[model samples]
Target chain A: MSAPKPSDLAFVPFVSVENMMRLLHRIGIPDALTGLAAYIEEDFRRWELFDKTPRVAAHSSDGVIELMPTSDGTSYAFKYVNGHPKNTRDGLQTVTAFGLLAEVATGYPLLLSEMTLLTALRTAASSALVAKYLAPDGADTMALIGNGAQSEFQALAMKAVCGITHLRLYDIDPKATEKAMRNLAGHGFTLTACASVQEAVEGAQIITTCTADKQFATILTDNLVGAGVHINAIGGDCPGKTELHRDILSRADVFVEYPPQTRIEGEIQQMPEDFPVTEFWQVVTGTAAGRRNDRQITLFDGVGFATEDFSALRYIRDRLEGTGFYQELDLLADPDDPRDLFGMLQRANDGAA
Target chain B: MSAPKPSDLAFVPFVSVENMMRLLHRIGIPDALTGLAAYIEEDFRRWELFDKTPRVAAHSSDGVIELMPTSDGTSYAFKYVNGHPKNTRDGLQTVTAFGLLAEVATGYPLLLSEMTLLTALRTAASSALVAKYLAPDGADTMALIGNGAQSEFQALAMKAVCGITHLRLYDIDPKATEKAMRNLAGHGFTLTACASVQEAVEGAQIITTCTADKQFATILTDNLVGAGVHINAIGGDCPGKTELHRDILSRADVFVEYPPQTRIEGEIQQMPEDFPVTEFWQVVTGTAAGRRNDRQITLFDGVGFATEDFSALRYIRDRLEGTGFYQELDLLADPDDPRDLFGMLQRANDGAA
Candidate 1:
């Protein structure tokens, strides 16, 4: 075969939230989560190839906007996400995001997709991937605190990843719990709306805290957490915003993704500088222990990381190949002669002359 | 008029590279540069309203990929840009970029446009704006140290912003000088292609360094300096990159975009931590002195900041309003019912439901 023409080169495919939801429904949510989790693990194994940095955040009085970027030698990916805690009151999501994946060699965007829905899916997949190593064997019950837009995702991902069959949900708003219940209706999980955080955590094998608040509100107390229960903290992901009590973090065996970032954004921010924590990659690579003893409480301080988004984008791109589910965006120019950008414009002005 | 429905909300319009060039050609480059510079100056005056952050960058061995994001209270903007010094050898532009503007309240993307061309324009406009406040009286002759894709824009912006009439150009490649000469034709600038860097700098009151090499190469030395030259350093924008000799920085007064970022990425990176430098915004806001004496050498260490792009996006959005130059992007969803994101999938499945 001869060299491919510039136009023949594969442009990255994009799936909007509308199309992404359609893709998930058509492929089935469990299968999508399974595929995403597998990709996340594979990417983690070759972590040395990635250029990772802590996210750059712009803070405001109401919320924060963050740019999380990461790259392997061949591909680069970044996500634009914002957290506005008061958004739900105005009928908007507390978190909304979109991302781009590009070729590293040419610096061309291959895929641009709405990350709002994908973020929820990937965060849940990441949580469940960690729970597989940190949760107790044959874990089936999970306490999901804060049943908002992400609650159903966490419940479904845990079901697929850890075979969890029972969910005890708690939230400050009864309407949010009802929405989560309605959304998960026929998703094959036994749901219980708990009266308080303590009721939700009682006897659960795993606990996931994903409450959306911009302040340092303690959603999980040390008294509520039990031995051998793995806690997945997702929402406390910026400086001045945290969900877990400091005492809860002190007693648990902490695991994190990218220590420098976790030190600032994760629940571990409350602890001392020398706080002992295991990087999740080392545990996944079999270099460190995950759930050491049945009595030890394990915590996956899951402030969403760029590497997970990289893996999720890879999985979505691969799965959508030949599926015809995405549209081609003119994100990068394919000039007949790349040197003549001005010439390309002149031709475009003359109606694609 | 009644408030528009969420689905009918006006998108902040987009301008692609082709459309942007057409807009510039229609409005004329001088008018656009002058308008953009005005918008930048206005934004600099209200610097405290912006949610600003240092760019998030992923550096590879050969180049760098960066995401610069900023927001006013109403709109959010971000630009994705890449710089590969060796790209020209492969017939590619050294810099390529695109950006997005979004509505803050609804988290809806208002515009997506190619910024490879826009970045060149904005960088030059920002440099000219700084030189307006920092350069000596009636500055006309400018030394163009790198005659690459950015040289013509810098020349034109200086003409528009500071009434620069003469340009002395030099580059390692003679073909780059030829390209710049061709692009600057009919732009009303007296251009001289010099054989050496020293020859280019002779008697020039304003010097712009825009070399593409990603190294600590000193393009300007102490011996070449003049008494009142306003040096606009454009290419030494990332870590481990510097353009001016440390001796020159020690003697000249430096002005920067953001202090924390300038300390790491600008030519000032070669200086000590305690080295005194004034922020350009402070000078614009009259909080700091710019060019205290006519004989003082001043440097605008222009390692392009996010706010400039924010202003550029705002300016383009305003100009392209009635000019039918933008295409609507289906980047965000406006579901009839926000809660029915899952329902949208079912409708798509049913086809014309």
Candidate 2:
């Protein structure tokens, strides 16, 4: 007799890029961003239970490939991401990613997704979540210092999660600023195309620096940063790549995701090894203070963390049910008799014959 | 105008379980086994060039999930594998896996394939490859002490790669041995369902122990092993899951792949630190000797490594060309302008409308 057909356990739920886009649009981007922020905030609040590790990176001359993994005892997730700043010159994305979430009990994958889109969403959600906790009350206007791929998501997430209504966008390339402005046109925000970083931060309550340069160029010098503004420094995410000058970090009451990782990859990579910083989870847990006074610069060194990816994947897994936006991929081998893998192959061969 | 269709760069070739079995059967199992052995040997010979790291593992009460990643300068490969022995009780395979091969320069994935079958094939091929160098001359009869998922593949690989044509199989459950005998019925082998391990080892020139128990168990006792017989111990791949007895390891001239990993996961984990073990690559490179004497007990402590998985993925990638067994998965988000990802999403939204 031919081998029995594989069961549902053999198939993994796979969300392709098209499906991910469809799902986000189905849920409404603003609502999805708000949902992701809630999930991230919840995960961060219980951060003490997570298995956190600095991303395992393989660095080359041109770029880096990394595996960021985290576990919350019941579920596990990991994202395979690559950052190649030079890729844009070849008409490729500077960053590309995919992720998987698995059941911790059986060690079987539950979902496989193209995380290029999800990473963009989650990174923005994480930024907005932090801003909600630390930004001055009723913060509305923001300066977005990088009008690249992630800029629009940041702007919308800030608006949806933090009630920000105005965006001042700036980039070295005029075309990039024009692209961001176009993308945000109908998104219900008063958008500005600023000529300089100095002009962008003029009357804004929040400053989000998200440039994509790989070097340690100071996009936001100490002279440009103003008091009472919550600075979300995102671009300085790797060793030797800090967006802000050292003076801003010293002046700001810095908050970070995970200290061990932030010390190496976040903006704190520029500071001394023993530099004082607050873990964001502590602020969420009410163990530490956030934005004590209006004059205090609460700089969130927002290097993307594995837990954030885990939270994003968790959110996706939750939203995937009852939705026709995913495909079942025959990714696992589930023989009727688990011990008879070769026999299963032989039966397949016989069926083929 | 509608959004431009995704380019070829946005698609990653995915080979599912059905296709992997079809590909293997199309190539012929024996030839594929030999081919995989060749690829593994070639990678082993250049072992120094690989970025080797012990698999990153997350351990739970029941099992472990692991990520094994390696890069050989031009290409990078990683395998996601999980071993939950209890899974077999639930009619799931004890291990399931999937792997990806990507170009290191651009970090763009070239191929994604189901690896549960590939893993079985590779492990068997690796065992037979080692046996080729160390087994006594003109050896044909071999005792396979574990009749689990990997047994028949081991029997076939030995026949294809080394000139072994006879087999003696034994398992704690007599049904397991019966299953193996039935599976290998017409595979050009004289198969025997031995009553015990002692009966299985009778007059066998090679003894292969591959039992899968989470705890330490002496599948092969020191007194049962005879001189000049090459012993391949494979099942002791995790921290506490060893098969052979401690005395047998001390008596044998041990060979290992990547000592750092082998020492922690191999049968040699029972032995002390700084135990004398020969790196198998040295043997492949003609620097280390195999089968030094007729009476010497040569044991291959076969713990799987990332480079071996890398080689398997490399072989799959090379063979996937021109084969219609793969489907293109829209796994990457490729915006027209890398910096205008939001604009691309907006255009996709417009197209959907």
Candidate 3:
């Protein structure tokens, strides 16, 4: 009848990279990491409720782009992540991502946000949370191998969530370890710059392997890892991209986010299909053993999962109310009558023209 | 290394709904439709060059949400769309979509645009482009049944691409037909609002059945369709959502986009799995017959596919340069050294603080 005014439902909140940074700073990084850990832990406690599917991926010669989607019946979330190691040579991030949360009932997007930062945070939180269950009791020092983008977050998340306060960092490139040392400077960890991966693992109760190479090279050998150490393997995440030796995988008690996915993307992909591994959620739910003995090696084959992204999305959505950390995007066309889309466009032309 | 300065790659161009509408008005709807049809035709000509996947779907009790992804080697695109027919009763669109294009090499997003408008245009363009090949020669009038949201776009696309100058429209609801007629006014098409589907199909060489229901109700029976007519069957784009009677499909020469996807989502889903149908690209390539003789019943069972969205995205990317119809968004977190992600976030904190 008259010109259609846009309904409130037409707007979806978007958190840009700037807003994501501000949100992290506003909440403080340690607090954000702690908050994310809680969310991740809560989701893991009810893991069976999630609709988990292996990420849909498109692989190329240089990289892989993946879409990870999961729903908790009422809410749905998906993250678009691309890993291009060569991108850094062109001054781009090795990994960049964005994600959205939507109401499953209406299929309307509730929030769209930059996920590059969030993914880093969630990966760290997940590693530390798994370490909380799998790492030896009184675990304090963590040897963070491959001191790249994820190193400091892993160090700080371990401190915030798992009561780990000491760190030993190493990378094939010395500059990466230097970068991580500089970033984790203000954080409350006794940081160490190690000469080699062997030196980094010395006297460390936890070993975090997060190398950026897209190859199957061994960052950790079986002999280097002692009987009682917990391994948080983060970088060996894609097919043909693994960091630990198959010998290391054979001796350690491997735990994974989701078995079907980890078998394809985790370090344990080197193992046969029927090789034994425990679901990390099962350990969280007390249905499976985590750290079985003082001398037993616990390995969290930490390939990132969709449910963690879902949790991060839920956390961000919950924190968005009156935060001024988001902008409303007019992403959907809202006509006066749903069936009169053309009429709506015509009126806009008439009004604008 | 110095703190990371934001790179040009950090930003992605975003076209909002208002901007998309303005872009449509800037390049008149007919020209845009014609342009889209050209892009679709060009892509169809080299259809084998694109990497296609059947859309990934999440079905609910009432509707389904789908992700349709495709790549043309150099670039990639995916559309996020939802079909909730009952949404109209709440004054919401049954289908709302947005899509993104990315560099295949780096997996960096090149463009993020509202595809609600674009999908409408592309779907119509696809139907009309197919009609150009399949419709009987000298087809001047199209019977546009189900005068709803997509009706006007289909009518105009036919006029712009298929040389159809007259539209005979009908709907179950009188108000819908009135809305479509009102929107089509001032356009060049001679529009008639018919009281019934049979009346609308009378004397028309092309019939487009596009109704929005979640069931197998027949909008076109075997007796209603005459020989030598082309049928552009849209709207029956999900499981159990056929608009034509089974007997009509038995007699018509059904052509579809990507048989693997069409066999599950198109009107052909109503037929036996072994029922024969031609791939539409074969007809475009002249490997198969379109409208071989005047008495042949050619049906284009249009279940929206991913490559068409890729074509629309490519068209939008080509048009975005120098148009100033988009805004750059900091959707990606770019670091100076791609591996120093933590350093980038730490600097963001330092600068902002």
Candidate 4:
């Protein structure tokens, strides 16, 4: 007799890029962003329960590949991500990613998904979630200083999570601003394409710097930032890649997610080893102060933590439950007899005959 | 009026479990085992160039999940594997795995393959490769202890790589030995099903111990082991898990894959922190001796290493070139302009329409 087919336990649910987009569009980008933010906030409220570790990175001559892993008591998650700044010249993305979630009890994978789009979503949602606890009162406008791949996501997430309806967009390449403006056209935001960073931050209460240079290039100087503004610094995520000037970081009361990671990868890398900063999770849990006065500068030095990716993976797995948007991938080998794995392979040969 | 399809660069070649078995069968198990051994030997010869790190592990109460990553400057690879001994009670394999290969220059993944079968092949190949260097001259009979999933592969690899043609198998459960003997009926071998470990090792020059237990249990006592024998210790691969008696270790000249890892995971974990052991690569490179005389026992403390998986991955990627044994997975997001990721998401809506 031919070998029996692999059991259902052998298959893992996989969400390809196309399916991820369909799921996002089905949920609507704004609603998905808000939903992701809710998960991030919930995870943050119980942040002490997570097994937090800095991402494991292997740096090559041109770029780096990293594995960011974290786990709650019940589930474990990891994202495989790479960043190569020079890829853009070859018509390739500077960043790409995929991720997996597994059951802690059995150590069996539950879901696998393309994390490129999901990463962009989670990063934006993380920023918006933190803004809810840190931004100034009546913050209705945001100055988006880097109009690149992440620009439009940041814009929409802000509008969905924090009710910001106006965006001032700026980029070194004017085409980038045009691209962001075009992408965000009908998203119910009043978009202004600005010529310079100074013009973008003119009357905005939230200034987000997200340029994509590998070196320390100042996208926001001290003069461009004002008091009572929440600075969402995104581009300065790797060591030696800060975007804001030292003067701005010096003046702002910085908030960070996972201090050990932010100390190495965020804009706070320029600060002293012991330069005091409040953990954002504490603020979410109402233990730490945020935006104490109208003149207080609350800067969220966001470097994108593993817990955020864990929250994102959990959110997608929950949302895709009955959607029929994923394919079952035969990624595991399940043999009837646990001690007979070779028997399984031998049977496969007979089946082939 | 519609968005263009994702470019070929966005697609990654994926080999599922079915295709992996197909590829192995197409190559033939004997030849594939020998081929994998050659690759492992070749990589070990140039071992100094590799970036090696002990696997990053997440240990829960039931089992452990690990990420083993390594690079040879040109390419990078990692395997995600889990070992939950209790999974067998729930009709799941105790171990399952998948792996990926990526370009170090571009940080883009090239191949994703199910590594459960490949891991088995590589482990057996690694054992036989070491046996070639350390097994006694004119050795032909192998005492295969613990007739589990890896038993047949080990038997075949020794035949292919070391010209062994006889097997003496024993397990605590007689049914396991019956299964192994039945599976090896067609393969050319003089199979002897032994009731006790002492009976299995009689007149045998090579002894392979591969039991599946999560705690320390002696499979081979010192009195049962004779002179001029090579011990392929396979299953004592984690902390708190060991198979051989301490007396046997004291009498053998131990060799290991990577000391930092083997010290914690291999049978040598029973030894002291500063215990002297030879690096196996040194033996392969002629810097250290393998077998000295007819009376010395040589033990290969084979805690699986990342480089072996790297070799297996490289072998699969090379052999699958013209086989059409893989499917292209849309795992990456590629936009016309690298900065237009949001635009790509927005245009997917247009394409859907």
Q: Which clashing pairs does model 1 show? A: A12-A110
lDDT of 2 by residue, A1-353 (tens): 01223377799999999999989988999999999999999999999999888898888888888999889999999999999898899889989999999988888888999999899999999999999999998899999998899999999999999999999999999999998998899889998899999999989999999998899888999998788989999983778898999999999999999999999888989999999999999999999998898888999999899999999999998898888899989999888899999999999999988
Stretches of candidate 4 off by over 4 Å are A1-6, B1-6
Candidates 1 and 2 compared: the better one by DockQ is: 2
Best by DockQ: 2
DockQ for all candidate structures vs. native: 0.30, 0.73, 0.72, 0.70
Candidate 3 chain B, poorest ten consecutive residues by summed lDDT: B1-10
TM-score for each of the candidates: 0.88, 0.98, 0.97, 0.97
Instruction: Please identify which of the two predictions, 2 or 3, would achieve the higher lDDT against the true structure.
Output: 2
User: Where does model 2 exceed 4 Å of error?
Assistant: A1-6, B1-6
Cα lDDT tens digits, model 4, A211-243, are 878888888889878879999998837888899
Candidate 4 clashes between residue pairs 3 or more apart in a chain or in different chains: none
Where's the lowest-lDDT run of ten residues in candidate 2 chain A?
A1-10
B198-281 in candidate 4: lDDT tens per residue? 999998999999988899999999999999999999983788999999899999999999999999888988989998899999
Question: Model 2, residue A334: what's the lDDT?
Answer: 86
DockQ rank, highest first?
A: 2, 3, 4, 1
Native-interface RMSD of candidate 4? 1.4
Q: What share of the true interface contacts does each candidate keep?
A: 0.17, 0.74, 0.73, 0.72
List ranges where model 3 is wrong by over 4 Å: A1-6, B1-6
| Residue A29 in candidate 3, Cα distance off native in Å | 0.7
lDDT, candidate 1, B267-291, per-residue tens:
9889889899998999999999998
